[model samples]
Target: MKDWNEKCAVVGIYNAYNASILSYYSLFSMQHRGQEASGISSSNGEKISTYKNSGLVTKVFDENTLKKLQGNSSIGHNRYSTAGEDSIDDCQPIFAKYSLGELAIVHNGNLTNAKKVRKNLIEDGAIFQSHLDTENLIHLIAKSHKHQLVDRITDAINQIEGAYALIFLSRTKMFAVRDKYGLRPLSLGKITNPDGSVGYIVASETCAFDLIGAEYVRDVEPGEMLVFEGAYSKHITMPKSIKIFAANPKPCIFEYVYFARPDSKVFGRNVYEIRKKMGIELAKEHKIKADMVIPVPDSGVAAAIGYSRESGIPFELGIIRNHYVGRTFIEPTQSARELKVKLKLNPIAEIIEGKEIIIIDDSIVRGTTSKQIIKILRQAGAKKIHLFISSPPTISPCYYGVDTPDKSQLICANHSIEEVRDFIGADSLAFLSLQGLKNSIQNAGEEKFCQACFDENYIEDLQE
Candidate 1:
């Protein structure tokens, strides 16, 4: 598997007086999905107000910004660049004006056919405002038959290929749709406001529901369209009723492995539990003798715990992460990224000294970060270092919303496990098997799950 970095999350809400507060909370819960940028849009019955910037959620929006956004309905986004550069225009809740009225859209997942769609739209006199694939969706809707908003949305979605879970906001209504394959995750929930009016919330993961005290509703059915009016909700069935593609059902496995917050319940499986099980499985497969199991801060904590429990190794927080670090990947230069990683993570020599440490991380996309971490540990006097990845190798690039590199850029896709281990300077390296990864999520039910990024089997028909 290779190390590819692409990810984002979206949250939408309706009928809440403090819509900005709820939006902030939801985005805060999904902060792990993306650290590069955060944006939010709120509708105050008359107009829509938005606030977005190139930074983490808290950094982008503050009390002053929230106070300025007066609206009863809102949509928010957290982004990690899968496509397009990190810039202000690329920030989400993209707005546009058309005959149907104004719309603000925030989307999760990528469209494999985005380039083709954009080309076609451009030929038809549509001017693109940004490089994001999401902009194509808005134009598609504008050009479609405008008999009804949902009908237009359905037609636009039918032309899109790859993973997507989108929340569309119109002047009077808020709607959400998930791709037929369910390549990404989307869920719906409801909350009660002080005035006794009910509020509707939609988010990429269940963790967002916890922040605003919204109850967990069922996941948005793959290929399902959900419409939330002021006080009512409606479900639109898929035009073509289908579940798993017989050829392949590849949901981005990374969502379960690294991208989602540990507290999230994705595909009905608790992310923390699944990650821990991956660690346990990795330990079982590798059987390495180590003095202590240490995690790479937040994302690896669960898996490290699992590895410790399964391997009977003591767990220690030998590496501390500074939560305040900004986006290192967007540091503008290689040296900047290296320096940022060092500033963000520091190995506690007192805890790691003389210890044979097993470091658990969700995945290794490029091997650069892993190499740096291992170097830090060795420099801190760790006798030996072992690396355990929770998910199987990401051999294939993701066409879905995730931001994986092209085939030429994926280091693991071109290298063997031993090669990757040697490259990272780890004494040993092991990844969870595909079957074991599936087994970890078996509690979620027998319905199929997408493992395309691990398997290279795209379930959606490219031709369609």
Candidate 2:
């Protein structure tokens, strides 16, 4: 709860050879998006088959389970439980049997109007099966009087409000759509089959495409739906695009700051380049003199490099993270929480001994982690510790699928910058300004983004 939790990952494969295997690889590449559970649904122009469980993709499915999928089209999900309770029923792709044949869906965002919609459905004598708002789609689609599945989907989406990058799988077709606000990312790709045919892949990140030997095609436009029909063997064409709503894109800005992989090209900009720019911007804003610059590891490496280059400070990988650390079921005691931090990230005493160091980090939520980090650095003989945050303070919680702590739990929300610095035991602390963040991206043109966590500007009414 202290760390900024993650959103889910959704992927769809249309007409690909061994579609379920490709879906498994795509989900594997995007494991950072979610790690709680993974599942895949496949259709071979007959009955739909789905297999999923509460574990990582590797543990959830093996060769035997994937062999049973038997389909040329597939949809997959990796969940971090932004909306529903952590249960077997909540794992996706949520399979259902309705009047319109068999259908399965994978979703990647939160529904802000879930309460009101669920209330109306229950009053209308609809029995629910799961805690997921995604299940609401199944109910709404099943209840629709519309004759065609496409029309029914439009009707169902019209009734919901919030962030969603959705992929719906049917017996012979696949559909991908993003909410009008586009608060989550979804990209399109093309895969060349061994038989000289072309298949299409859609995923939450471009890195998924790379892993499965798929080439990036573009992002799925906001407020648009792509309907994939016909087999890929003969007539391989683009998915039919339906403009469900007038374009009003407001993609999530935090994708660049934290969630997305550095190698990804989100919203057509390289994530690593944008992150480096954020670091350069932070360095320009704060001209603190330090003996050396150190990154918090992994997430902070790019930004620390930018800062080091800008400030002429030597950059060192002062912290090393344990890649093998897995979550422990029994939560550590409050007094012993620092041990958990130590287990994950440890300082290099040789690099920090008697040195005035600047530590670069992406963002601070509860301040506990940063405090523990600073404590370890001091014990390593750091003379002065200056903490530099790459992004602006997270002052609000995210309702657009990201799992963030409430405002009351956000240390930066209630405390002044200096007060936070004192609490973290850092000699100096500074965060990137909103203007500086905007200046980091190049030629962002005519595009709007959702930075609600930093600005408290909720795009859609949370109560809606």
TM per candidate comes to 0.90, 0.98
Model 2 Cα shift for residue 393 (angstroms) = 0.9
Q: Write the per-residue lDDT of candidate 2 for residues 280-396, one digit (tens) a residue.
A: 999999998889999887889888999999999999999999887788655678656887888889999999999999999999999999999999999999999999999999899
Q: Residue by residue across 58-143, what tens digits does model 1's lDDT show?
A: 88988999999887789999988888877888999898877787889998888888889899999999898788999998898888
Which runs in model 1 stand beyond 4 Å of their true positions? 1-4, 232-250, 327-338, 444-447
Q: How close is candidate 1 to the true structure, as a TM-score?
A: 0.90
Q: What is the Å distance of residue 295 in model 2 from its true position?
A: 1.0
Candidate 1: how many backbone clashes? 11
**Residue 452, candidate 1: alpha-carbon lDDT:** 64
- The global C-alpha lDDT for each of the candidates, from Candidate 1 onward, is 0.81, 0.91
